[model samples]
Structure formats: structure tokens, C-alpha cells
Target chain A: MTNPTAAMLVIGDEILSGRTRDANMHFLAGELVRHGIDLNEVRIVSDDRDAIVTAVRALSEAFDHVFTSGGIGPTHDDITADSIAAAFGAPIDVRDDARALLEAHYARTGMELNAARLRMARIPDGAALIDNPVSTAPGFTLGNVHVMAGVPAVFQAMLASVLPTLTGGSPLLSQSLRVFRAEGDMAAQLAALADRYADLSIGCYPFHKDGVFGANVVVRGADGGRIDAAMSDLARDLGL
Target chain B: MTNPTAAMLVIGDEILSGRTRDANMHFLAGELVRHGIDLNEVRIVSDDRDAIVTAVRALSEAFDHVFTSGGIGPTHDDITADSIAAAFGAPIDVRDDARALLEAHYARTGMELNAARLRMARIPDGAALIDNPVSTAPGFTLGNVHVMAGVPAVFQAMLASVLPTLTGGSPLLSQSLRVFRAEGDMAAQLAALADRYADLSIGCYPFHKDGVFGANVVVRGADGGRIDAAMSDLARDLGL
Candidate 1:
């Protein structure tokens, strides 16, 4: 069977506006790689409903799994769940399980479970709830889309709980060779190496230091031994 | 006049595979914002030719400007220029200007400008070259799309030169207030504040610490004086 593929939809206006740098995409990418699930694309959209709906539907159909982070909070702008549910043609309502979890959480802290706070209880029909360790507002999985909180801690916790349930491919393997040459100079040789090993992904990342140009060529594939072998061939071909 | 909007297309398989954490998107987003340009969307796609062609065509039509990073190297996988040219129905050939630049760079460094290196000189007809401070291989601009180096430093320098050539909208003004309260508890008040200032983008970013929930409320607008007024009213309403 082919490798299981995934996509991430980071929903936040703050991220798109340059107000907040996203840390979730990297975290989830690494986690998915470790589980042998390849994350092929990432789309970061504003908190607009149409944008959310369009992205969710498109990404859900394109990949084996889709994980969305953000816009699940109690605020009026937090519309991810509703949009996602609508995209799946699944009606949304306050589920009893989610409500009980929120009620118990607020009761323990002696806080008001007001209308705004209860907004977190909305979930798509026929979805399995993913528990948040840091907070009581539960994330849920509808079809292949796993919805999580925007806050990093809660999102991470929910993702950790959800990932174990999904089927993963062979974990990706990688090897790196740091070259003290400019990427442009080594581009052809590197390209040849990439072509030689069609299964491996060879990336030439350039870094500059005080007028000196350098690059790190990372060769990645599903097999650790094959990746290392390909890296050796690249180093010899590039004279690195 | 409407704000000059730009979107970034990051073309690379490495980024999608979780092999590399992207640094270019964040850099471009901040730089574009500082230059009074709005970055509407960013799409990270693999080295597939059709994907690049489709995205380039769509983004070039939608935004005032499109900045693409990665996939301009000498490798077989570096197909950005060819794909972009296909999108514009333009011929891709090795231009005299780009070849001369590469020759001069190789001459200065005492390196051979081999056939592989000469591949770097391929540019779409009618494209103007953008200077690369960190490397000799040049990036270029075709219409509204500015193809940039994937290397962060080189990309930043090329972008610097490009920004001075374009017209911008009114600079985006912003003010932030860090408050100690959960997002759910602060939702009603923040919503009212947002409703009062319809022109402003009021974002509430929540943070948790020591079993406490806190949020930073950022107010953004095109007008400096109006942003300040809105922020002041927000602080007064929140009593912070």
C-alpha cells in the first residue's frame, strides 16, 4: 500500500496577519513524520467561514487525514467547528458528552459556564471526541478531519491523544550532509543525485556566514539504510 | 486606493515532507507587512510542475503581487521557472543577462561555470532579474510575480530591492494589550469592543500559565490615530 498522507489547515487570522508566528505546523509535521504519515500540504487561512469551509472540504478529500488547529475557542470569531461541520454536511449541536466534560471542568474551578463558555461544546454529528488534557473543551474527529484547539498546549495535548488512533505508514528516515559550498555551485550535482535516487528527497538549504555560502543537503526516504546510502553517493558526487 | 496585496508560493517537496521547517514564509510576511503591503495567502506546494503552474496562474491573477521561493536551483527537481513560464505561456531560455551575471560571479570566485551551472541562467522571456546578494544565481520578476531565492538572507535582500520598486497602501497600524484572563471569560467584552470598532481587526491570542489563562488583544487598522483610539477604549473597557 502507498504511504498514508495528511494535510494541515492552520486557521487563524493572527497567523496570517504576521501578529503571531505559527509553531503548530512544525510540531504536527514532525509528529506525523515520526508516525510514518506524510504531511504533504499546509494551508493557513483567516477566520473567515467561507475560507474555512472551502479549505476543510478540499483538504479532507485530498489526503488520508486532515488536522485543523485554531478557531475552536469561545469567542464569536471561533467558527472552525461550525464551518467544518457544514463542510461535511453534518449538522452541529451541543453534544451531551462535551457539555458534561465542560460542566465538570468549570465546576471544579468554580467558574461560570456561561453561554460564551458553552460555545466550546459544539461538535459535528457522528464524530469521536478527542480529550484535551490542559482544558475540558474536547476536540473531535469527524471523518478524517481531526479538530483541535488553537492554543498550543491544548492543541498538542489533543493531537497526542488523537494520533495513536490513526493508521501510520513506515516512519520516514533522513540523513544530512553539511557542505561548505554555495547551493548554486552544487545545484547540478545535487540535482543529478536526486534523479539517481528517485525515491529519496534531496533538499539543498543554503546558509550564509560573513560572506561565505554554505548548504545542508538533507536526503530523506522511508528506509533509513537507503537514505544513508543515498547520502553517501551524494557526498561523493558533489565532492563534499 | 486598495491595499497592494501579495501572496507567497513556496515550492519544494522538502517543506511538505516535514524534512525542513520553512523560514521564508514568516520572513516575507513580516517584511511585506512592514512595507505596507498585505500578504493575503501563502501556499506551500511540492516540485510538481502542474501544481506550480496552477498555483502561479491562480495567484498571479488574484493578487497584486506573488513572491515564490525555492525550486530555482540547478537540480532536476527545481522546476519553478519552467512551470511559471508555462503558466504565462512564455518561452523559457537561457538569457544573455543572466548568463553574463553567472559568468562574472564564477570569474570572481575562480570557479568553472559548467553546463550544469549555466542552467541557473534560464529565465522566462520578458522577466527582469532580481539581484541576489548572497549568491550569483539571480531571481527574477515576471509581471507581478517575484521569484525569490529560498535561502532566507538572499530572499530578504532580493525582497528589499523589490519593495522600493512597488507602490504600497497606507501602513498598517497596530496596538497590543496583554491582559490576564481566559479567552472564554473575556469573549463577551472583546466581542463588544470588536463590534464598536468595525474597521479595526481586534485579535485575542490566549496564553496559559500556572493554571491561569491570559490573552494578548491586538488591534490593527490602516489609520494610526484610529488604532490608538480603539486600543485605548479596549484598555479602559477591560480595566487594565
Candidate 2:
């Protein structure tokens, strides 16, 4: 659990081309932050197999964990499962566990589980199923990569199921102070304070208002006491 | 105007560490599609100067236009102005045009334009300033890279100003047909239809509901007639 490094691969043409406003990226980013995982990189690619395989391989190897969103549906563009399996050099088939879930879901509601629907049950060999409570189609974990749905609701539920399984370090704690001053004015003091509180990661987020300049100073650390102390010191120094 | 290729470079530590869920990516993606621009690649990097400079150069060279969001604030971490100038090998200083805007904004609102606030007025040599109606601190464009604020509102306003100035191709037209079948069931038909409409780009979006699988087939092209014809043929083939 040493410095959980993670990367996000948003696979969707709608997102890349701007047809769909992506809600999952923001949701996942917030989740990763709360779990004390460092999300290092994010790449949004179209629903292309070559691109998905290339990005999945590169990111999975580079980071401790890789989370992918979009694809894995019952559509023509939903080729993520097969592509990821191909990247991992594994054979993909209709897994019994996933098929069972699909069957149970269909049986309960009395619907036909057609071939198009069966595509959702396909899982790479030796992969663990990630439950999707929102939808019967389950996500899977192969190696360090977790393949989840693109829809915000289903993706979030799948992420929740997969998160508890991973090993995480101390949960990242943060405190923010909304200050009515420019970042440059707080630079010297903030720098000095950040330097003093070596354990905390101090960030200055500057925003513009109705013709006013202001910044939000965020102090993050694994230690709650350190973050609190640093934030208090920052406020005192800024005369907040 | 030939293809109108574009890339987005998101500069912010908040985004990299998953502290900020970026909305600009999706917004810009949709905007690019409407403007007849092809969004090829997207990279989210930290607020580090070297990272910003590196991404700016690579993306600006590779694509016809490179748009960046975040780290353009009046804070210490807002090093985008300096980094963009450095990437272009240009000198960065307080520009008269930008300064006038900031000074006038502060004067009208009766707020002090302190040194920290004035940092927002800095611009690179030969760069054009972008209007920020939401905030007084203007974004600037150096070479092909257009820098904007991270806030969704301000970023969108800046884009409105910048978009009209850029050369764009014919606006892309899109049409969609909703099908009540799984992706795999519709895969073969969708693929065949996509081949038939070779001049158009067709996408199949799948959604699952209460043991039922359905898809929305989207056909996109420059001509409305072509898009409608493709959708009509698709709907007939799917028996919808």
C-alpha cells in the first residue's frame, strides 16, 4: 500500500468527441482521492480496440492500479472486455459466475437473455467478477486493471465493489480554506508554511469572481493532525 | 480548415490527484464536435511547470489547436502563463491590454488589485488575450495553445470567444435511433449499417434496464439527409 498510484482510462468516442458530458471522471477522481490513492494520469480514447489495448497495457504496467470506464456494454462499440483480455494474453469466454448473475436477473424479471445480452456475461479467464448492483452486467478485475461500465450510476456501483478489495494506505485527509486574496499574495506565506509542514501537500487553487480574485488553499496529508495544524497556520498567516 | 484537429491539455495537480473532477474535458469535447473540430487526444497533467510546458509543446505541434484548462489562476500554482511563454521561447511580462482589463475591473468594483491579483495580467509576448466575462482575469492564447480558467463557467465563456475566431469546417450533424435490443444482438446489423453509411460515423450506445437490454444507434455526418437516411435504414433493419 505504499503510495497507491493509479491511472484512469476513459474509453468512449462520445466523451472524446464531446457528444456525452462525462460524469464518471469526476466521480472516480473524488473516490480515488477519498481512498488515499494518487490518480496520476487519465487518458480518454475512442471506442477503438487498438487504442484501448494499447492504453490498457501501458497504463496498467505504469501504475499500481488502472481503472477503465465505458465500453463493456451489449453494443457494437463495447469491445473493452475482449480488448483488455487480449492485452493481458488471456482467453475470454462466457464465465459461469457472470452468466449465473445474468440468468438470475433475467429469471427474476422474466426476460429473454439473448445473444446481445450474453455479451455482458463474457469475462476473461482468471478474472474476478465486480458486482454491478445497478445492472446485471458485472465488471471484472484482471490483474491490476478494473473494467467498469461507462454509465455514471453503474460505474460508481462497480467502483464501490472493487475499491474495498484493493489494498490502500492511510486515507488521504484534506482541509480547505476559502480565502479572499489572490494566490500570488499568499505565495510567500503559503510557501513558507508548506515548507514548514513538510508532511502536508499544500495546493493553491485560484478562482475569479465578479471582478474579484481569490484562491482556495487546500492542505492534504495522511495525518489529520498535521493537515489541521498546517491549515490553521495558513489561516493565521493570511489573517483569515 | 481541413479536419480541424484539436487536443486538450488539462493542467492542474487537483485533477491529477483526483481532487478535482474535470468538467472542461467533456464540455470542450462537445464544443469541438459542434465546431467541426476533431478532438484527437487529451492529457491531464499536474500544475508542475515542466509538465505543462512539455504537454503544451507536444500537443500544440501535433494538433491544429491545443486548448488547456486549469492552473491559469492568480495563485502560485497558476504557472500556465509562464510555462506557455517558456514553451514558445517567448518572454512573459505584464501586458498593457490584460492589465487594463484587470485594473478597470477592480476600479469598477472598488477592490484592491494587489500584486497577487495583478499576476493574472501577465501574458507572453505576441499572445492574444481571451475575454472572461465570468471573471476579470483574462486567459491568453500563445501559438495554437489556448489557455482558459478551470472553473466550468469561466472556461465555457472563454471558449465562446475563442471558438468564433478559429477557422472551422462545416458543423457536424448527428441523428440517433433507440433500439430495444442488446449490443451483441444488434452488433451484426449495426456493423452492416455502419458499412453501408461509410461516409458517416455510427456509434451504438447500450443501456440495460430491469433485465432488458437496449441500444441507441447514433449516426453522425456533415449532411442532415445522410444522417437521417442512415438512421431510417437502421431503424428499419432493427424492426423498430
Candidate 3:
């Protein structure tokens, strides 16, 4: 059977404005792959309400799971929670469970849970809260969408909390052979090899460094034996 | 007047599979912002023909310009050129100018221009060539979409060739104040400040590093005076 598929939505004006380089997509991609889930697509959008709502709905419908990062903080720009609620047509308010977590944490730290801070307690009607070990505010899941924090450390922590609950399939296996020749020289042979191994995804990534031109021929598949056989043939063809 | 808007399409299975982190997006984002072109969206899709075609068509129609990176190499998986042609309903073939350039480069380098190498000469109908300073293979601009090589150096070179030909708007100006206070402590004040400056985009990016909690408050707009004024007020409000 095919592995479960996922799509990611990154929401932040800092990323779109060229002020921040997004680390969450890469982190999530690696984690999902390791867990035997296929991350099919990723979209990075600005902190606009309409854009976030549209992307969340489309991706949630298309893939098995939709993961989103950013716009969950307490500042004015943190509108992801509300936009996600609007997308599902779910009524959102400050839920008691979420408020209690924030309230307890703030009380221990001698801080007041003011209006702006309480905004983090808002959640959709039928959503489950994802634990945030790095901070007090919790991310929530509504339908198939998993909302997480934008900060790298907090995003990673949230993923750790949420990944164990999902079901996965066989992990994808990959092997590579580095060919110290120009991609143009090996293109025809590689194409014939790929045609022969139709089930395996054979890719040639070209690289040029230190006056050397070469390509990395990677073979990826679920069957380890098939991948081994393909790699052996590829090595023989390239005379590696 | 509003700045010209643009979108980016990153085409590669390596990216979606989590084997490679995309640096081109960050580089292009900075370049587009510097040129006064607003980057509205970015999509990363695998090296599938249908996916590439659909994304290119959608992004081309939705934005003023679409910039695409990856899947333009000489291997079998490099089908971006063909897919782009199909997206625009334009026929593609090896043009004489492109072929001549490749032939001369190979001859000078003591290499043969074989079938695989000649594949790089294929250009869609009515498309202009974007010069590649790092390699002999040329990128092309078809209508509103500009297709470039996936390699970071080559992509940057192609962008340099294309950016000068597009129109730009007023550059966005930004100023920032670093507040050494927890986000929860400053959320209320920051929200009030953001509301006060309606025209400027005020965002607070939180950070927790080395046992300290703080945030960076940024004010962005086209007017330098307004940005300076906002920054001064933010600094005083936060007592930074």
C-alpha cells in the first residue's frame, strides 16, 4: 500500500518578506519521511487571513494530514488560530482547558494572564490540544490540520508531541552512487536505466565543484532488494 | 502605486523528500524585495510533470511574474522544459541559436555535443534566453514565467539576467527594535502599538536563547519617516 501523504503550510510575513529563512518545512519533511509518511507539497504564504484560510482548506482536503507552522503567538499578527477556525466554519472561543494551562503556567511565574496573553487560549469547538513543552501556549488540531508554533525550537517540540499519534506505512529507502562525469555524458545511459527500473525513482543530481563535474545518481524505493539490485546495476554501468 | 507581485515554483523531488534544503527561495526572496517586487507566495512541488504544469499555470495567471527553479538539467527526470511548454500550449524544440552556443562551448572545452548535451538547447516557442554565467546551458523566459536551473549558483546567475528586464516599485523600508522582555509580557502593549500604526506592518518575532526571552519588533512600509517614528515609539514603549 502507498504511504500516507501530507502537505505543509507555512504562515509568516517574515518568511515571505525575506527577513527569515524557514526551518520548519525542512524539519517536518525529514521527520515525516523518517516516520514513513510522504510529504507531497509545501506552500509558504504571508500572514494574510484569506491566504492562510484558503491554503489550509485546500491542503486539508487533498492530503491525509496537513501541518502548519507559524502565526500562533500572542501578538497582533498571530491570527492563524482564528483563520483556521474560519476555514472549517467552526466557532472559536477561549476554551477552558487551554486557558487553564496558560493560567497555571503564568501563575507559577508570577505573571498576569492579561487579554493579549489569554488570546492563546482560543481554540475551535472540536479540536485537540497539542502539548508545547518549550512554552506554555499549546497548539491545537482541528479536523486533519495540525497547527504548530512558528519558532524553530517550539515547532520541533510540537512535532515531537504530535508525530507518535499518526499511522504510517513502509519507510522509503534510498541509495546513491556518485559518478565523476558530466551529467550530459551520462544522461542517455541514466535515462535507459530509469526506464528499465520503472518501479524505482532514479534521479540524477548534477554538481560542479573544485573544477570537477559530477552527478549523484540516487535510487529510491520501498523494496530494499529492488533498490540494491538497481544500485548494483547502476554501479556496473558507470564502472564505479 | 502597488508593487508588482511575484510567485516562485520550486520543482524537485529532492526538496520534497527532505534530502535538500532550499536556499534559492531565500535568495530569491531577498532579491525580489530589494528590487521592490512583492513576493506573495512560494510553492515547492516534486518533479512530476502534471504537478509542474499545474503549478506553473496557476502561478503564472495569479501573479505578475512567476519564477521557477529546478528540473531543467540534462537527465531523464528533468522534464520542466517540456511541462512548461505544455502549460502554455507552446511547442518546444532545439533552436539554432541555443544549439550553436552549446556547440561552441563544448568545442572550446574539448568535449562532444552529443544527444544528451543537445537536450539542453530545447527552448519553448517565443521564449527569450536567460544567460547562465556559471554554465553554458541557458535558462528561458516563457511569457510571464521565467525558468532557471536548480543549482543555487546557476539560479542566482539566471535571476541576475532576468531581474533587470522587469519593472519595479518603491523599495520597502523597515526599522526594528529588540525588546528584552517575554512576548507574553509585551503582547498587550505591542498589539496596541500595532493598532496605532495602521499603515505600517508591525510584527513581533519572539526568541528564547541562552536563558533569555525577548522579541524583535519590526516596522515595515514605504515611508522612511513613518518607520523611524514607529521604531522610536516602540523603543520608548518597551523601555529598550
Candidate 4:
């Protein structure tokens, strides 16, 4: 069976402005691959409400699972949660369960649960909260969309909390062989090999470093035997 | 006048597989911002043909400019050029000018211009070549979309070659004020400040470092005076 497909939506102006390099997409991509899900697409959009709503809605409809990071904080620019709610046409308010969690955490810390802080408690109806062990403010899940924090630590924690609940297929296995020749020299052979092993996905990445031209051929597939045989054939063809 | 808007399409299986973190996006984002072009969206897709064609067509139609990185090499997996041509309904073939350049470079390097190496000479109809100073292979611009190499160095060179040809608006100016208080503590005042200067885009980024809670409020606009004034007002309101 084909693995469940997923998409990631990164919502932040910091990323678009080049103030921040997004780490969440890479993190999620690795984790989802490990969990046997095919991450088909990833989109990074700014903090604009319309962009967030449109991306979330489109990705949520196109993929089996949609993961989003950023803009769920207690600030004016933190419009991800609200935009997601609007995308689903769901009414959102400060839910008691979420508020109680925030309130109790703040009380324990001797901090006031003010209006801005309470904004984190706003959740759409029928949505479930994703736990944040790094911070008290929880991310939430509405339908297939998992809205998480922008902070790297909080986002990772939330992903760990949410990943166990989803279904997965066989983990994709990959093996790489480095050919110390120009990609042009090996293109024809590689193309023939790829045709022979149609089930396995072969990727050629060219690299030029220290006066050496080479390519790394990575083979990916669910069947380990097929991948192993393909690698062996490639090695033989390259005489390596 | 509003800044010209642009979108980026990153095409590669390595990025989606988490084997490589995309550095081109960060580099391009900074460069576009410097040139007064607002980077509105970035999409990363695997080396699948349909994925590349679909994203290129969508972004090229939606934005004033579309920049794509990766999959333009002499290998079976390098299908970006073909996909882009398909997206624009343009015929692609080995053009004499591109072939002559490749032949001359190969001759200088004492390398044979074989069929695979000659593959790089293929250009889409009506597209202008974006010079690759670092390498002999050339990138091209079809309609509003500029196709670029995936290698960081080559992509940077292609961007440098292509950027000066595009029209730009006033460069965006920005100023940041660091307030050593929780975003929750400053959200109301910050929201009011943002509303007061609606023309300037204000972004609040929360940080928890060294056991301290703080946020950096960034004010961005085309007018330097407006950005400075808004930043000063934010600093004063925060008692900084």
C-alpha cells in the first residue's frame, strides 16, 4: 500500500524576511519519513492572514495530513490559530479546557493569565489540543491540520506528542552510492539502470568540490531487496 | 508603489528526504528583499515531473516573478528544464548558441562534449539564458519564471546575472526594538502601536534565552523615517 501523504505549511514573516532559517520543515520531513509517511510538499508563507488561511485550506484538502508551524504565540502577529479556524469555517473561542491548562500553569508559576496570554487558549470547536512539554501553551488539531508553535523546541515537542496518533505505512529505505565521475559521463547508464528498476526511485545529485566532479546516486524504495539489487547493479555499471 | 512580488520553487528529492537542508531559499529571500521584491511564497517539491510542472505553472501565474532551483543537470533525475518547458507549452531543444558555448568551454577544459554533457545546451523557446559564471551550464528565464541551478554557488551566480534585469521598487527599510518583557506583557500596547502605524508592517518575535523572556519588535516599510518613528514609539511605549 502507498504511504499516507503529508504537507507542511510554515507560517512566519521571520522566515520570508530571511531573519530566520526554518528548521521545522527539515525536522518534520525526517520524522515523517521515519514514520512511513510521504511528505509530498512544503510551503512557507508569511504572517498574512489570507496567506495562512489559503495555504492551510489547500494543503489540508490535498494531503492526508497537514502540519503547520509558527504564529501561534501570544502576540499580534500570531494569527495562525485564528486563520486556521477561519479556513475550517469553525467558530473559535477561549475554550475552558485550554484556558484551565494555561491558568493552572500560570498559577503554578505565579504569573498572571492576562488577555494576551489567554489568547493561546482560543481553540475552534471540536478540535483537540497537542501537548507542549517545552511550554504550557498547547498547539491544537482541527481535522487533519496540526497547528503547532513557531519556536523550534515547542514545535518539536508538539510533533512528538502528535505523531503517535497517526497511521503510517512501511518506512522508506534509502541507500546512496557516490560515483567519482561527472554526472554527464554516467547519465546514460544511470537512466538505463533506473528504467530497469522502475519501482525504486533513483536521485542523482551532482557535486563539485576540491577539483573533483562527482554525483551521489540515492535509491529509495520500500523494498530493501530491490534497493540493494539496484545499488549493486549501479556499482557494477560504474565499475566501482 | 508596492514592491514587486516573487515566489520560489525548490525542486529536489534530497530536500524532501531531509538529506539536505535548502540554503538557496534563505539566500534568495534575502536577495529579493534587498532588491525591493517581496517574497510572498516558497514551495519545495520532490523531483517528480508532475510536481515540478504544477508548482512552476501555479507560482509563475500567481506572482510577478518565479524563481526555481534544482534539477537542471545532466542526469535522468534532472527533469526541471523539461517540466518547465511543459508548464509553459514551449518547445525545448539544443540551441546553437548554448551548444557553442558548451563546446567552447569543454574544448578549453580538454573534455569531450558528449550527448549527456550536451544535454545542458537544451533551451526552451523564447527564453533568455541566465549566465552561469561559475559553471558552463546556463540557466534560463521563460516568461516570468527564472530557472536556476540547484547548487548554492551556481544559483547565486545565476541570480546575480538575472536580478539587475528586473524592475524593483523602493528598498524596504526596517528597524527593530528589543523589549525585555514577555510578548504577553506587551501585546496590548504593541497592538495599539501597530494600529497607529498601519502602513508599516510590525512583527513581534518572542524569545526565551538565557532564562530571560523578551521579544524583538520589527518595523518594516519603504519609508525610513516612518520605520524609525514607529520603532521609537514602540521603544517609548515599552519603557525601553
lDDT of each: 0.85, 0.83, 0.91, 0.91
Q: What does candidate 2's lDDT look like per residue over A12-93, in tens digits? A: 8877766777777778878887787887777887777887888899889878999999889876667899999999999999
TM-score of each model's chain B? 0.97, 0.93, 0.96, 0.98
Q: lDDT per residue, candidate 2, B1-240, as tens digits? A: 357888898887787666666788889988888888988778887776886787788779878999999877665567888999999999999889999999998899786787767888999999999999877799988889899988888899999999999988877788877788656667878878878888888888777677676777788778899888888888788887
Q: Candidate 4 on A124-204: residue-level lDDT in tens?
A: 998999998877899999999999998888899999999999999988899998888889889989999999999989999
**lDDT, model 3, position B79:** 92
The CAPRI classification for model 2 reads as: medium
Q: Which parts of model 1 have CA positions greater than 4 angstroms off?
A: none
**What lDDT tens digits, residue by residue, belong to model 3 across residues A133-193?**
8887999999999999999999999999999999988788898888899999888888989
Give the poorly placed runs of model 3, Cα more than 4 Å off: none
Worst 10 residues of 4 chain B by lDDT: B170-179
Residue clash pairs of candidate 1? none
Please give, for residues B1-240, the per-residue lDDT of candidate 1 as tens digits. 668888889887777766677888888877777788888777788778887898899789978999999878765667888888999999999999999999998999888888767878999999999988767689999999999878777788888878899898877778898888888888998899889888888888888977878888888878888888888887788777
Q: Candidate 2 at A240: error in angstroms? A: 3.0
For candidate 3, list the clashing residue pairs, or say none: none
Off by more than 4 A, model 2? A86-113, A121-126, A180-188, A206-214, B15-20, B86-113, B133-136, B179-185, B208-213
